[model samples]
Target: MPRFRLLPDEQLARSPLSQLWREFARQHSAVAGLILFTAFFALAILAPLITPHGPYWQNDALLLLPPSWSELGLVQYPLGTDDLGRDLFSRILVGARYTFGIAVITVIGALLMGLLLGTLAGMSRGVKSSVFNHILDLALTIPSLLLAIIIVAILGPGLLNTTWAIMLALLPQFVHGIRNAIAEQLSQDYVIAYRLDGANNWQIFSRIVIPNIWEKLTLMATMALSTAILDIAALGFLGLGAQAPSAEWGAIIADSLDLIYIAPAGVAIPGLLIFLAVLSVNLVGDGLRTAAKKRREN
Candidate 1:
């Protein structure tokens, strides 16, 4: 009997989740983004264990304290203390949880709605396509920020409301992308063959169309994740997102703005984390797109 060894690439690509992971790891920026994202997530998840103080608790003695150096025998505050004497580091860790949670929820909601609407529109050509496409165009024509503000204002401010706002604002893009992909797929010979093989519309859609376009959908979802994070941060900055006492990054930045001169690190810390998170998401999205294109070409 011959000794057998599994090929690493072959094994990875054979598993559904591992295939994407392998693709992510092979790209330089994607790997870096994954590392940064994982670090932030870990910080968020392990906040209580790592943080010296609760994010909400404040101490007057520590108020507006600058970052301390061990050499100076003053090492209490690592990232410094905010105006209320709360640890900036702790707040940031908690804020990551809030921001990322909202983004993930919003993205998943938008993708679900868009996929359903887009698939429906694609399966039905004439009047259905026309109406759906017109609606999508109208939605796309509106400024996303303005739309989000309108929705949030109508729904009232809160985490749930903010998420709904982001989802509504994001749905149009997904609809548009999926509509285009599905329309193109419908024109392919495989679809015609499926139709001729006694396959009903639903069967053709479920078995053939969806699987073929899933890769594109995954790419869109990754890009949407970045956009969702940015949108939520913007909403928080404008006071329409995670409200006060929530330790959200946007709210943290908003509160720290007035105290920038007093403790610049307060604003800088949250802002830096938001920036890095969004950047990492975008890098990962770009890497996915590149890998997907290569896969298609091959």
Candidate 2:
């Protein structure tokens, strides 16, 4: 009775969450992507505090200055000055607030709306379901960006309008994907058993359908986020999103385009930030997909 025995490794069972975390962590690229995105988010949040100069501040004397490493660079402006003599580094940090922040908010809205509408549509019978499916299919046929642009055109383009337009454009994808996933999960024997056991539609959706399709949901979310970022930037570049005086990444690039020949880094830095944001999100999504697959196999 006084003797205590150590548990065997096999007996020391890990929780499902811990197991999933371990699986996700095994993918080095995913970890790197997570870290990268976190850094970007932090920079966005702390931009006002950490930036050496105001994003809108202009220095007539420092026009088109190169980065600190460049021959003509100044120590004060690490990433150098834009064509307007605004601090390029500060603009970048401030731009991240609009670019990354808007995409995140849009995706969350789309996901929530999708989950509600898709679940109802999936659970509907006969003609109602068919009508929902048809509408979703019709919406899906239009390219998301085109749909977003059309909505923005109708709503009158601005940052808030662009966010709404993108959310609406993304809604159909989430709805259709989730609807199909729920339908597939409903056909499974366990779901049938739940139905036979008298589980209501809400109960079944909450307990069975959602859990089964979480992986798909996560993948769609990441993909949607990346798309939102690009679309926001594109709209901003076209002057239909963030307007003049905004330091949004796309607007930054558009503003700096004229200076590309004279100060290439001005354009390149913002462009590179967009590229990295998209790439990191995609990498993390891919890693999660692989981890989910492996978890299922085991």
Candidate 3:
């Protein structure tokens, strides 16, 4: 008797990103989040070309027209018109650029800064580590929003300053998290082996530690992104970020507060988008973490 042989086809080689994408795609919530996340960025990036009316264009006659779906709403303004007759749809579209764009900048800045400090702290002994730890503790104690508010206060309000403020506020969490991961990685047998082979700190870190902790960094970065968005929104709501006619979600909602009775959709739409955007990032981040944990186990 003869047994059938397994198929001869070779399994395709995959990179970590490809593997992570496959894993994230396998998760139902993650797939949905990815779709929404993609759509959100797409909308933001394409706002200028796609939006029917100028975000700042005003017409008193068209002011406060409810969503087309409403009884008296105009069909042309699907989401509705705001108090100033600017298209709520267009403004929200443009707002995505300010909201998500700033979030991206803040997350990236925080990531780089955190990774640098954490690496320094992790690699060093005594004073260097102690100083970083103390700073981390101090940062952790002060609330992130409060920290951002203080930074903005010092820098004065503007887009660049606001982005930096958000980044600074989020930096401590990254520093602490990355430092711990690096410290643990450095304690492993491979690292000790590399050291025995006369590897310098940079060599070991570049060759071993980074490869190992890369997944963890991605997870941390994704988590930080959600926090960044919330902070940016809070700043905009408090008049500390993108000023009038700029159309950030929180700013839009803040501006629309007076018209809550007549056009609550203005408030509700931006609020819903913020909720959806945060939820999407969180779900995707969770998926990445679940995938990472499973990988580590195997």
* TM values, all candidates: 0.89, 0.94, 0.93
Among the numbered candidates, top lDDT falls to 2
By TM-score, the better pick of 2 and 3 is 2
Candidate with best TM-score: 2
Across residues 1-298, which tens digit of lDDT does each residue of candidate 1 receive? 9977665676645754455556657889888987887786676677768777788888898777787753322466678778888888788877877787678778889999999988887777788779878988998998777889899999998878989998999999998999889889889998898888888988877888888888888888878888888878888889998888888888888999998987777788778888898887788788877777655443
List candidate 3 segments past 4 Å from native: 1-15
Q: In model 3, state the lDDT of residue 205.
A: 87
lDDT of every predicted structure (CA atoms): 0.82, 0.90, 0.87
Candidate 2 error regions (>4 Å): 1-12
**RMSD to the native, candidate 1?**
4.9
Candidate 2 has which clashing residue pairs, if any?
A: none
Better of 1 and 2 by lDDT: 2
Per-residue C-alpha lDDT of model 2 across residues 1-298, encoded as one tens digit per residue: 6977675575358655566667889999999998988888787788889888999998899899999998889999999998779999988889998999889999999999999998988888899899889989999999988999999999998999999999999999999999889989999999999999999988998898888898899999999999999999999999999998899999998988987898888789999999999988988898888888877665
Question: How badly does each model clash, as a count of residue pairs?
Answer: 0, 0, 0
In candidate 3, what are the lDDT values of residues 11-94, reduced to their tens digit?
246666676676667789988887888888787788889888899999999989999999998878899999889999889998
